[model samples]
Target: MSLYSALYSGVSGLTAYSSALSAISDNITNVNTVGYKGTSTEFSTLVTESQTFARYSAGGVRAIPRTLVSRQGLLQSSSSPTDLSIDGAGFFVVRNSPSATAEGAVQFTRAGSFRPDAEGYLRNTSGNYLLGFPLQVDGSVTNTGNVTDLVPIRITELTGTAEATENIRIRANLQSSDPLIPSVVAGTYDVTNAANNVATGGVVPNFSRDIEVFDAQGGTHTLSVSFVKTATPNRWAVEVYAKPASDITTGAGLTAGQISRGTIAFNSDGSLDVANTTPALLDPLNIAWTNGASSSQISLNLGSDSNVDGLTQFDSVSTVISTSVDGAVFGNVTGVSIDRSGVVTTLFDNGLTRDVFKLPVATFQNPDGLTRLQGNAYGVSDFSGRYALVDAGTGGGGTISPSTLEASTVDLAAEFTNLITTQRAFSASTKVITTVDEILAELNQVI
Candidate 1:
């Protein structure tokens, strides 16, 4: 009976070692796999009571395979813009379906080799869609960090719309040493009067500048501002013209050659006096376009009332320092990129960048307890606890390193060593079984 048990024990040993060999083989094969975790076989002894001796028993080994899921892997640099890796604790939230279909279960992974498909949804090698929080136009997260708030990041609809020019800020210096324009009377000057043209033996503007402004429909129009020195010290009369003054005829409302929009007055210090400015309340210039395009209201900010942050009058040559307008033409999506904060930015052909999505990193209380899944992914388990979906670099989640991938955690050298020892153990178990068989044959012959 004891000999029979010995044969069974040897068989169990052989099976245990075979399972260990299998685990070692798997580890060696996936050494280059991205985000791959290695597994090892854990052995335990099984015992049964013996009739003759109370403490004596027949025991055999059993193998339990466990994955080293928490082990960290080295990060490798990648050329792809969507490749991402976690430097610390977190997983990228993903889903199998692009449609938020209730049948599809959510998954987590560290294999961030992602690229947008034809539909602009970011998906990994396994075809799982990457999920994140949608960003508002102002670059703020739209929803709380909940599983339901996650959505597939799509950039195909990122073509920007045209924005009409509403505000224009001018920063320049007006020459203080310039002589007053001849034939220009202060407080009684009229921009439409024929006496104001120096070419026609009247007064002419000391300086003038023209800039292009866009209408609501993105049509370009030339707006010219002419400055004339008045009799009053440091005073200059500002007149806005839709075209050259020489081409316009003096008339009420608007004549065929009428080009004057309105006039503004500046103090001796070169700062705009808002109260005394025309269009009455320092209002925006309302241009009535003769072209087929609609009219445009443009606000001209010369300088602040309390500071010289805008236009200034100084004892220097008249020069245009800088001019900026808030507007952009319609453009198509050109490229996409991710930053350290995990914000996906879409670049447009109109030289504009928009934050389309904020990629959230999911972290667990016990990542090692997560259930291992196929394709280098993981699923939720009771031991792992609930996940905390947080912004990258916040709430214990690691910051994302764009264009990098995490390498497998398997060590080839260690796996080879394990292979040698498992092979020897398996051979020894076979020898035990053969020895038991030889003993049984001898006993049978003697009987």
Candidate 2:
């Protein structure tokens, strides 16, 4: 190769190195930036003729290319439920609504650091809505929808009278030895079904109880429950049958007949317990009786009970209790349940019911193939294929940790080393330019 060509090659090398230095510098600067991905340089030679050895400049600069592919660094756990980190593949989709235009509007992200917006929707620092399908009541995603289009996380107080509106769990031990026959005189073994509404007895002895309770609106509902005593020793099956109360004051037709009936076993101790049932229901409708309107009473008329040894008979039963049915009387959040699909639900002291939000997760055809969008976010691309919708901890997604967040994965020491290397390259490139100028000045002086 000619001397001039050799010189050009060196210059090109300097140019490429300088660009690489710049890219590395950029990476170092963002070392503390959450979800930032580092970039590297690439170079190739341009050969005019292979036969002419060293004839061409070390191929002028090839692309001082930015990397479109990178392995996401390991995730750091911030212990924040809202702080999310992708363990394997996929990106946290965020809508860049503020900066969006018709063309290439929504931007995806890797940063899981987010907070609730004023509207209670989860959004990133850029105010982008994280994308994913909203969970349905049945724990199913409706449209495989993206978050950018949906409303923010909803926040508001839910109100209602969580009365044993349906059926107050009835758990009580009817002693095996206790001679309690059905109400009728001739040892009523058979229970009479009146109006085809309440079932007297089947293979199992199941009964329904209707209680009149006022709602948050001071409206009464005729909550019915069906109880089934499974004949299983010390165990019974119970289910709730509920209907709004037509009226609460008059006990005329408000008998323990309208409630859907289920049976639960009472241990030998007479304490009602719902076994193998979640939230365990125990005792005569472990009635979580509430008066959403105000302190009220619902009758528990045993109607008639024939005792053992043919001795005792107890008829009428009734009681009054307070309710948290209105705003002034907010119910306490009680039990929190997560279904198999990771949908979180909160049971309140009040009777009102609701399914708050479904924990969402983004899955990719190839998680490793996802292109980093920085800020701990990833984007879908040809390499990423398509997104596979899923919920937390399912289909290779991470499980959610409520009240926690993920920390930054950046390592300060490693970033500093990279910074040093970039600085050296920058200096070397400047030296090359200086040397070139010096040589040109010498030639001009000699001429």
Candidate 3:
């Protein structure tokens, strides 16, 4: 009985050493793999108790494979902006399929070598799609750390974008010595009358400038700004109307092609007097587009309160200075970039950028207990605590490093040493089996 038990124990020893050698080989092979964690085999003794006091039974050894998943690796820089790596602690939440939203299918990974696929979805080498929360047009996201809110990051859908004009700043000078319109009042004029309206070409403006304003649909519209000095001293009647009167329809309290009609009051010293101006500069120009676009409230920056800037009243000839409008034409997608906070911004050829999405980091209590899956990903296991999705660098999550990747944590020297030790252990186990065989043969001959 003792001999049989000894023989079985030797076989078990051989199996344990074999598993160790296999683990060492795997560690050595993945030394250069990106975000690869090394595995090592640990041995524990298995004992069998004998029924009789004098007899003893030997049990085999068992090998337990442990992964060093929480170990940090060296960060290497890359040229691509999509490459990312965790600097502190945490993994990127991902999914195998772009449309997969099941909580059980969610995965966490340290590998960040991601690139846009044919459909403009960002995925890693193993086809794992990156997940994030999409931002609204107002730059707001209603993310409450819920996993269901995550969606595959797709950048190509943002084909062409147009920015609506938010504000218009005019810095031209108005001639103070100009005579007022003889037929029209200084501050009040009929917008519907053909003989006095600015949109219908009824009254030629003393000083007229064309300004281009962009709509939400990226359509550009020209606005004709006219200034007619009134009989009132230092007061001018201003009317801003859209060109090609069919571009827009009049809203309440306005006429056709009328965007805004106001009166500007200037001090005797050529400075703007905001207290006397009708339709105060604080009010924005309300415009309702005929095309399918949201209504716009255009802010006006005419001039300063005291300085001779913006819409200035000077005795010299009215000179048209530079006018700046805040809006962009239709801009095509040029590229995308990510920041340390995991905010993905889309770049446009028209020099416009928009915040599109934000990546979330998942942290666990015991990362090593995570189940290692194919393609170097990890799934939540019973041993691993529940994951908490958080913003990058917040709530113990790791900060993202753009244009960088984490190298494998396996050490070549250590793996080589372990390989040699495992090899010797296997040889000794084989020797034990051969020695047992010889002893058994002698016992058989005696019997």
Pick the lDDT winner.
3
CA lDDT of each prediction against the hidden true structure: 0.77, 0.47, 0.86
Q: Point out the worst 10-residue segment of candidate 2 by lDDT.
A: 307-316
Superposition error at 431 for model 1 (Å): 2.3
Candidate 3: residue 43 Cα off by (Å): 3.3
| Deviation of model 2 at 167, angstroms | 3.0
Q: Write the per-residue lDDT of candidate 2 for residues 2-96, one digit (tens) a residue.
A: 43554565577667767776776676676666556666666677554556554444345553555543346655656445555555444555665
Q: What is the TM-score of each candidate against the true structure?
A: 0.83, 0.57, 0.83
lDDT of 3 at 112: 92
Candidate 3 Cα RMSD (Å)? 4.0
Candidate 3, 294-406: lDDT as tens digits: 88889988877876778889988987888999888899998899999999999999888999999999999999999999888999999999999888999999899999999
- Candidate 3 has what TM-score? 0.83
Q: Please give the RMSD to the true structure for each candidate, in Å.
A: 4.5, 10.3, 4.0
Model 1: ten consecutive residues of lowest lDDT: 247-256
